[model samples]
Target chain A: MLSETQEERKMAEGEEVKNKQVLFRNYIDGFPKESDMYISTENTIRLKLPQGSNGVLVKNLVLSCDPFMRLLMQKNDDSGLFGCYTPDSPITGYGVAKILDSGNPKFQKGDLVWGMTGFEEYSIITETESLYKIEHTDVPLSYYTGILGMPGITACAGFYEVSTPKKGETVFVSAASGAVGQLVGQLAKLMGCYVVGSAGSKEKVDLLKNKFGFDDAFNYKEEHDLTAALKRYFPEGIDIYFENVGGKMLDAAILNMRIHGRIAVCGLISQYNLAEPEGVKNLMPLIYKRITMKGFSAFDYLAHYSKFYDILLPLIREGKIVYIEDVAEGLEKTPAALVGLFSGRNIGKQVVVVSRE
Target chain B: MLSETQEERKMAEGEEVKNKQVLFRNYIDGFPKESDMYISTENTIRLKLPQGSNGVLVKNLVLSCDPFMRLLMQKNDDSGLFGCYTPDSPITGYGVAKILDSGNPKFQKGDLVWGMTGFEEYSIITETESLYKIEHTDVPLSYYTGILGMPGITACAGFYEVSTPKKGETVFVSAASGAVGQLVGQLAKLMGCYVVGSAGSKEKVDLLKNKFGFDDAFNYKEEHDLTAALKRYFPEGIDIYFENVGGKMLDAAILNMRIHGRIAVCGLISQYNLAEPEGVKNLMPLIYKRITMKGFSAFDYLAHYSKFYDILLPLIREGKIVYIEDVAEGLEKTPAALVGLFSGRNIGKQVVVVSRE
Candidate 1:
């Protein structure tokens, strides 16, 4: 999957004696700039877990590029709810890794797993509870950082669990070309629901319609009036809205919502960079329409992991569910790729490949 | 009970020949004014239902004063969602009435029923499906306009159904002295929740604490920083918010919400009269806290009316639930009573007492 990388970048030249990390330099106010963080080429990593600790020492192969990571780059009161990243340290996020040494009986050295780790070549995960052991490795290993990981389950839970899919219902997804959005569209299609998505570009819109099997998709950047655009796609009104980009898009979605509609608030990418997020004035329609707007994180649905894998693995194996990753080659490119998310540069799941093996 | 009115005001001078009605003068632009409607003292009324029609003719006794009536008075696009009042015609709302004649088997002469009907002395109700026959009369007959009718069911459904109560959740209510708010507080207290309320004035705030048994109360008008005030009271965070008055209160509540908190959005009383409603800028908390904000109407909760009465009627009879009504003297004062809702003039459930009988 990471074909452009050289074998030298994949090798740890000095083993555990030297490490590389993407460190958080300072707190960000608006959109995170690449300069707000930096590439630290020389660091030390302990080869083993400390005594009496259940933590796993891992060699991270791939790092996930998620929009929520932007929220972590800020200075906030009590770290602002989602737990802000500490400045002067490597940022932590979902990544695919191989266990270097495990203090817990459940994992072993060389075990491949995916969960929350650091944006570095090697990470010492203090909390190994959320990590899942990767199996059925017929697909690319980097998929564990994306479609087979948080974003996959997030789309599944958000669509099936939160939206409570009803056959023939009209669904509108914002940020439709993103990691979660692409999968959600396919899942809705599988459930017999009419699915439409809004993306930021024509290429992404085309991918949504052609590759992801979305009923239709429009480039939100091209539409000046989203309310009228939604009306054009959903003349009968939207029954379920998978809200990924909050603000004016959310306001417009609320206006186009039908009675008893459900809005699953997954991610608010549009508001992540704003100093003061946009005011939503169209909420009165929520009462008239009796809409239910629910905000949730995928961590809450991890209990359904086995069931999710049951549904997803077969789809991936049968080519029923397809994933497209925008791979950024090398650890050096990770900072720019993460920054690219805020600017909508990635066409699919933005993943940084640290190694191929 | 029509105690302030002279006996002449209660009498239908010419029986069926003279009917008193409140006619909508015209569509209001912002906030319904007393000039938007007027009382017509001399108008003919039908004494009986037309042949083969399933209509019931009833002599109205009490009319409900609800904030939603303000939306009905405005000239909106098809009244926005809820049906609008027709200009130059008698306005319609919930009322208590005694049947004078009936063509439907579900009702007979002298049957006391309360439901949506003309805001007039006598009304021929064609659709009698939603009307509830008076089952218990130990309480005040005018209670039908407030506690025993729509507001009672609304509060019960909002608290127990929409908010989904637990034994010890922290509860907050905006407009806590009003019809729905008063009962939601009592119900939460009864369910073993620590409930706090926010009202517009000192008197209403006092009523919330002293009369309604709220754990604490505040005058939102006096509090410059609602978020800080909420933080002081709910040092931990709010678990349930019965949203009656939206805008800044809702914004503050979102900031002070605990993980998995629920907000039952019943009405936005503050935004009802505003030409441009204030935007809720802090919905991101909904994601971090995993909050659920459901916007609903009492009309949707009518199926729970029997269960609501089962919970409330005994509370009223046993003196466990107390009610406060700001009763207008007669039908002549109905227009002023209705307009007073926007200014928070009436103390509790604003009711128009048409007759003692």
Candidate 2:
């Protein structure tokens, strides 16, 4: 997979190439549709960096479609930490890339890296600090966008750092079949916990129970009373809740939490597309239960990436951990792949293959 | 204040007394009304404990009228941590009492104590473990129902322990003129933090600024846009929010929290009377800001009561800490005093003087 053509090897450093890119059309209000983004081939990039530049230029391999990306599509207040996507420009997200050229000494040509990159064939990332050189590639490169990248680190920080699970404790994860939830459930199981998950579809529910090794799984769409459904599964009550789908699910989880329960707020994918987010009504239970609910982002835990990598890499090598991905081929399919997240369309970690090389 | 009449001292241990009681007529649904409770003198209680019973018989002194008692007035599921008030029975709550007779070795006759007791002239408390022998009489005995008891410890734990406040940080407290919020604001100020509080009335707002020494205060009822109001007061953002009133206040506080802000959930006086608690809409800010929202009760911090007492006793005696209380006279005024909390009718810690000695 690392082999380069003789033409690419002989190509001059200053050579130019056509770049196929996915561009954000405009700020979206409701659920993002495929038309909110468009594929463009009019842009081009040089194979060399500008003089005195400290950026890294790379060819994107696999791009990740995450729920947080939807938040970037909306018109955000400047007060928030994240910046919104610029219209008519290439949308940026986490991806695995092969360095085509570099002005920074830390990265060299052909170095495999995974971090923030454009949803295009080529990107000149000015923030070199955002990129991390991929240390081990013995496993599938696509895993860098799922199990070995942002989603993987998210599960590690959320489960081990935030949730603080103890042995034999009961755990519940919302949006359990998604990239982060799947990993959290597996991590809880590895810690000898009774893990239960809730998803929107029967296929994802089956995957959670059979493939992810969750002790129990339920289809939230099929449950009319979420509180009652959770009570049935966790008769004793939930000890840790990995919150992904907020709104009513969060309300229901609050009611079923045990004393001193911890809720790790990862993402609220359920409320991202709504004009107004649904209200959480059961917070009163938090007082009597002595619960702690914390919200965190993956960027905060990147400093400890090595520690997480050391723990997870071995599990993957020994077949103790399993990762599932729904890959969409070609940059042209990026729009549909990204839009599918809001509707729970893609089955596992949604990824768009921009380039096989 | 500890003196008893000669007749009381000579009375036989098994003598019965005319117990004037405030009985909970029935399970209530909404804001508890004065009519929901009735003054009853039909019941008589024996001063002596049953044979082999390790209970203490006490004559009530000062009774606490708290917001939590409203929760007990409603029919509750047995799953919750606290028990509900039984129909046609004297409602139970925190109070200061003088032990008339004791079968438990932990308590002695004529000893002053404060703990859970019936809302009557006399009560036989079987759970002697709940009682704490009053150690100091230098402060007003009525202080046991407010600054020296539950509300004081609540403020100590929420501010110093849960909020993890730092000097120069900003603090916001809702229901600021009330028992818990008033102490929380003062505690933050004592730690060299800037403090702001919100209450329902202009009088409370004035008391917050002038009497409690809060940096600023607001009348929430006058603020049409709570988020905008909070933003105006805390342009830099709130670091610690001692949450007393939930619903819109919580929603507004969430929007104004700084990065890594902490919210200590002490009480939700605003939502206690509602048939359905209001939904909190701004919880999404918690993620981007990496905020921690925790719910805690004073009972959890009781083990450290002696440590807290050592710190607070001097503050009260030296005039460094001032406590304001709304004292209602007579046992018959108990129902009206308890019912006034929901309407913001009480100015400070609501206490009923059941007996002076």
Best by TM-score: 2
Against the native complex, each candidate's DockQ, computed on alpha carbons, is 0.67, 0.77
Q: A-chain TM-score per prediction?
A: 0.94, 0.97
Write candidate 2's Cα lDDT for B106-149 as tens digits. Answer: 99989999989999988999988778999999998888888888
The alpha-carbon lDDT assigned to residue B116 of candidate 1 equals 92
lDDT of 1 by residue, A147-250 (tens): 88999989988998889989999999999888999999999999899999999899999999999999999999999999999999999999999999999999
Candidate 2: TM-score? Answer: 0.98
Considering only N, C-alpha and C atoms within 3 Å, which residue pairs clash in candidate 1?
A: none
The digit string of per-residue lDDT tens for model 1 on B58-85 reads 8889899899898888766722358888
User: Which regions of candidate 2 deviate over 4 angstroms?
Assistant: A1-3, A6-13, B1-3, B6-10
Worst 10 residues of 2 chain B by lDDT: B1-10
Query: What is candidate 1's CA lDDT for residue A347?
Result: 90
* Candidate 1: segments with Cα more than 4 A from true spot: A1-16, A50-53, A78-81, B1-16, B78-81
TM-scores for all candidates?
Answer: 0.95, 0.98
